[model samples]
Target: MNAATMRAVQVVRAGAPFAVTQLPVPEPGPGAVRIKVHACGVCGGENLARLGLLGVQLPRVPGHEIAGTVDAAGPGVTVWKPGDRVGVGWHGGSCFVCDSCRTGDFVNCADRRIVGLHYDGGYAEYVVAPQDALARIPAALSFEEAGPLMCAGITTFNALRNCGARPGDTVAVQGVGGLGHLAVQFADRMGFRTVAVNRGRDKEAIARQLGADEYIDSTEDKSPGEVLGRLGGAAAVISTVGSSPAQADIVQGLSPNGRLVVIATDHEPIPLGPELLVFGRRVVAGWYSGHAKDSEEAMAFAALKGVRPMVETRPLEDAEAAFQNLGAARFRTVLTL
Candidate 1:
């Protein structure tokens, strides 16, 4: 591919694998910035696009966790210029005129455009993004590391920090996968008494090393929630697992007035009994990837606290394999350009 065109892996249709193809390099429209993508993280939900579950347009590039440098700027793009290091996440861009945006709650903007879903994303050598969607990448964080932080890191970090849990309070992070790993680190370093909850002993050591004060392996025929309660009820339980059972397994374990913050995107209905909520005053809520400024704060905090995701790198040509190995792999996948 020349400077005029770039290589990208596009999903031609639902249930089909990504096809490596060449396309003309996209130009930034008004208020946009073109990034020379250095790295893009492969998220589990990207598979939804392959399955046509995300309602994305066909023959599209799918990726939301992106990190790179700006190479060009569009008209009226004053905040960012060429050579600026940046990353973009799921909350791509919001309509500034929307009520949510007007109130500075861009995360809930009714007209939000989801990257890789509403528009082309950084699953290519180059991707153009709206200026407002870009998060400044910290120099201390590598492009590969910053890539996942845009989505996985920001989602986990942003949720935990804002979930009403205080330092020294017990916080349980369910699942030891992509999002949970970062959640564990943030909870630990942020001064919370961290508990890592997951099935199997394989990730126990890793979780503890990542700052978990306690590791709960749920395979021993004990409810993770009950176990958490036994160790002094958790003030907050962040469910990062995609399984419905895994999420249900922790609802009853929260401390009185405890909050359950869910960051996973599982479509299955979460079983919630009214009794559990009324009896303990427990509440459950879901948080999506935050706005670009929120992502910037997350990146800075991760850098300052030395919290980083366990990541595995793959060549862009191995995009299909990387996407296939998402959940089972010990570390999140990052595609290097």
Candidate 2:
């Protein structure tokens, strides 16, 4: 391959397999910077685009959690320079003129774009990212560790920190995979009485090791709500799994005026009974991955607290395998270049 071209994995058509092929290493456009990718983390949301569910344009590269070094910068891109360690997450860019952006809530901007879905992303050796989407990676964090933090890490960390669960309240993290594991750590570290709710006894040991003070084995207990109710209910439940039933089961376990903070991108609607909301004044809300500044803060917090994600890595050429193994990754997956 010449200097102008680089290897990439592309989904040539919806519902089709990812193909390893050559594409021109993109040059940075206006207000953009070109990155020499060191690592790109796989995300569950890619399944939507891979199956044509996200209405993504064909022949796109699919990845959002990216960590790399800036190799070039375009005009008007003063915040980033060549050789800077950086990362980009799901919130690719937004129209700064929108009311949401004007209010400092770019995630809600009508013109907000998502990495991998709205445009090409970090599934290649080089990706051109908007300057506003970039976050500086700290020198203490490795590219592999920082890659997943760009999306999964920031989402879980930001959601729990802002979810209204007090430091001493009983906070339950429903699910012990991917996002839930991190949620448990954050809840415990943040001084909440952390509980891990998972299906089997297999995760109990790890949950305790991760600082969860209690474990709810849903498979053996059958009803998570009943189990949680017996423990005096949770002040907040961070629902991280995609299963609607799992989300529904936890509602009865919420303390009066408690919240169910939904973060998983599940397509199925969570069935909610009106009584659950009316009787207790309970609330359900969703939180998206934050902007670059939030991502930076999440990284710094993780670094300070020694919070790390369990990741399985594959070479860039094995991107297809990395994508396929996302479920079995135990927590998260990263492709290294």
- Per-model C-alpha RMSD: 1.4, 1.5
lDDT of 1 by residue, 1-337 (tens): 2488898988898998998999899989999999999999999868767787756889889899999999999999999988899999989999989888899999999999888888888889999989999999999999999999999999998899888899999999998888889999999989999999988999998899999999888997568888888999899999998777777769877999999988885789987678889998998888888999999999999999999988999999899999888767777899999
Tell me the whole-model lDDT of each prediction, alpha carbons only: 0.89, 0.88
- Candidate 1 backbone clash number: 0
Model 1: residues with Cα > 4 Å off, grouped in runs: none
Q: Which pairs in model 2 have colliding backbones?
A: none
Task: Give the per-residue lDDT of model 2 (tens digit) for 153-197.
Answer: 899999998888888999999999988888888788889999899
* Deviation (Å) of 169 in candidate 1: 0.3
- Name the TM-score of candidate 1: 0.97
How close is every model to the real structure, measured as TM-score? 0.97, 0.97
